[model samples]
Target: MKLKQLSVALFTAATLTAGSNSKADTITTPEVITKTTSAFFNCADYEVVGVCFWLYCTITGCTVKTSAKVAHYNPEITTQTYRNAEKPPWVETRVMLDAMQAGHDGSLIGIILETMGSGLDELGGGAGSENKAASHSNMTFTLTDSFGNPVLLASKVIGSSGYVCDPQLTPMYPYYVSNLDTVAWRFSIPEMFYPQSLNPFGSLLGSNSYNWGGYYPRIGHVTNHDLVKESGLIAFRSAHFLSRRGESHVYTTIAQNSREGFWPPGPLTEHSGKWQQLAPKGETSCKTFPLSAGTGPSDGLSGYRSDDGAHVWNLWRRYKCCKDRGDFLYDIEW
Candidate 1:
């Protein structure tokens, strides 16, 4: 898994399952998103990870553009704080994300869902231990227009499989090494066996895909942490590619803090390490509530690192209060 030599807090399943219910702690970056703006950015300094690459738009917070509010959330906010699987870890939150865009003559709309699912995971393939990624943070989407309601529910995690490759792997190709390098990967099954934004059919900014034989929008394992509720033992790592044509965003909410922004899961198309200013919406401070008793504000809404040796991971209470109430307003933000 690209293990950076950074210390992180450990939030094991046994510890979390002991009490289970975690407080709903969230932090809206910019810490003051006043307006809405859309632009591309790359924040590798902050350790923001993407599906394949390792960055996100610093200014716009890695947005997924849409004409309407995707979910009940504002365009500049992301929930799923407290860094663990949801308590009662088997329940799935309905409408975790709900966004629709007019399609096919503006008759139908595209429905995207990012439900927080919980179930026992027997993680056998990559890791030999049981994990929760088999269920949590699963993405399900559907596009409905006057013509029809085509549904694209996620059968697995995100980026596990993409639609860019054909059955014979003729299309989904390798991507470049860097934003400026722009060199494609050697086209051969032996050279390119995995799905990566860099290994696109042509370029990292071009049509990239995954092995659809796995799942439509397959996701890899979340390294060092689960989606929410502080439920995980160790980190996981794997490369993923973007499938359909839509907005994309990511988060490394579990990583350590003192950071300026969230870790992006991938690059901003082909742009990385570039800067772009987005329009500020208004002026607002995203709130952070108190954690357990003596935990204090330090653990309330924090950014933790998988390698950072700190008590912050076990200090804060799982976010049961705000819960992932309104995170789905924009196109897609993980």
Candidate 2:
């Protein structure tokens, strides 16, 4: 009955693998990079935006060099939320945190804020402290080649397309770390004092009353009962803060105006970018927030909350660029 036994084993494996919300705890750096890069290719959102012209010169004469300008979304950030800051579920972030600790031990101000802001740091869900769950988050740049593709995927893209330009920011950098920015992230500081934060029409994600939970005052604390939605809000808040400049955060601006030969993405606007679930479970496709933001056995989003309230999402942003052809940019035929 050896063949029969093999068949039974295969059936069992298929049963386990067939689910929308199947999950894993932590995602390694290689998996994150590979999956995201593969998703980039699968997206099929690349387009020819315009034609760029450059002035090419030779000893004999000068000529106009032309190339196709293309635009597509890039997985520029890996945003995650979890209860603990000392050890996140992201492999790369954990490694970076260790190195940061080794180099600087801990910031004196950070230690002070952590102590003074103990219970107030993250408000938990449910009544009383028994069901309480605290959350912290990080927004970090994804690892990519100079041209914005993952190292392994870069070769394939370059081989196929011939050329691609670099992104505005370098890869593998942390844009926002909740624990490191306590005054603003934990306490909300002047953000709470802002007029829009208090207004009914401004500074909110989804709505406070729609059972989706409110996302204003953009801090690490919330009173929602749903763990998944809470984590989603935390991630969304991180994205919102990183999109624009002049917020109460230490973030590199992602906004750029189109220049001569190169064209970069502008500031991130709500509903423009999309999120792909990376941990707990993974999705082959990505969609805008709230629409694809549900999780669990009842929901269709296909991922469940982690045991420690940890979650990861790949944030994809649109970018347009063209290869530098010659000495100076001549014109863009849009």
Say which candidate scores most in lDDT: 2
Q: Model 1 off-target regions past 4 Å? A: 1-24, 27-218, 222-267, 270-334
Per-model TM against the reference = 0.20, 0.74
Task: State how far residue 176 of model 2 sits from its true place (Å).
Answer: 2.0
lDDT at position 195, candidate 1: 51
- Ten contiguous residues with the weakest lDDT in model 2: 140-149
Candidate lDDT scores, in order, read 0.18, 0.58
Q: Show the lowest summed lDDT stretch of 10 residues, model 1.
A: 143-152
Q: Please list the residue runs of candidate 2 whose C-alpha ends up more than 4 Å from where it truly belongs after superposition.
A: 1-23, 99-110, 114-163, 207-214, 292-297, 302-304, 327-334
Model 1 accuracy (lDDT, Cα)? 0.18
Residue 275 in model 1: lDDT: 18
lDDT of 2 by residue, 71-121 (tens): 777776677777655446665455444443332235544464557655433
